[model samples]
Target: MSLRHAVLAALLSGEYSGYQLTKAFDVGVANFWYARPQQLYLELSKLESDGLISGREVVQQTRPNKRLFMVTDAGLAELARFAASVSKPSFIRDDLLVKVQAVDHVDVAPVIAQLDQRAAAAAAKVEILDKILRRFRGDLDEETYLRHGSPIGPYLTCLRGRLFEQEHHDWSVRAAALLRDRATRNGDPPPVSGQSR
Candidate 1:
């Protein structure tokens, strides 16, 4: 999907400065869509030129002046159009996956470490997201919120992130166990006269 639609979707919540949008994208949208501050700013300008969004300069008391951005009708329309379109599924392109795919020819130490690191990062993100979700609960399950109130995109993506993170943790623990098992056996005698390969 285009960054144009992503920016519009972010603005759907409310007006946000480029900095705020960048952080939001990092924490909230990093799972499915990724964007940097420069990319968001460039897209903001492009959106403005394309009549999809509008920006206003906001003067701050003790901070640098920032441009606050909001979605225009055109932006909302574009997002709606995107919402109606069919989306193809995407899969992981992780370097750690590359190592796992070639495990027969590669040492497991570095890949194990990388998976461990990724699992830790995913856990940290889950904690952060849980906090955000708790703030939104208000006597309703997050699932109800997704079904009834507010835009479902963030909630759905957040669910995806939470599920994927859990999978990461589970996969990492399994992989680590296998690696540890191999490590433990590496220095042992050859399984009673090489019974099997």
Candidate 2:
């Protein structure tokens, strides 16, 4: 999916200045999509020009004027069409995955370190998501909110992000452990197909 769609989805929450949108992307949308502030600013201009979104200048007492953006009817229609369309599967292009795959041929220390680092990052993301879920759910418990909350889309998306981060954390820890275990063996070949060669 394009950053355009992500921005549009964010505006579904309500109107936001470009600065606020950048912050929102950093905290929430970064889980599934990442875009720099510059990219967001540029996209906002494009969206406004395309008539997908409209911006209004806000006067401030001390600060310079900033434009707050809201989705236009065209934007909402576009988002609806996007939601109805079949999207291609998402794939990762991470360099760390490639390194992990080639661990047998390369040094293990760096790979282990990278895995540990990734695991920590994933854990951190899970914590962030948990906090966001709580804030979003407010007085309701997870089960109740999930079962009866209004506008459940964002919560559901956040749940998916949390689970994905958890999976990454679990996999990284396990991969690191297995690599360490293999390193301890004194030249014993790795077991293959239920037997050691």
Give each model a TM-score: 0.87, 0.91
Model 1 regions more than 4 Å off: 143-151, 188-197
Residue-wise C-alpha lDDT for candidate 1, range 1-197, written one tens digit per residue: 88888888888889998889998898887767888789988998999999989999999999889999999888888988999999988766776877888876776666666666766776787788777666656677877887885666677777788788778777876776576567558863221111110
The clash numbers for all candidates, in the given order, read 0, 0
Ten consecutive residues with minimal summed lDDT in candidate 2? 188-197
lDDT of each residue in 13-77, candidate 2, tens digit only: 99999999999999889878999999999999999999999999999999999999999999999
- Local error of candidate 2 at 180, Å? 1.5
lDDT value for model 1: 0.77
Best by lDDT: 2
Instruction: State residue 164's C-alpha deviation in candidate 1, in Å.
Output: 1.0
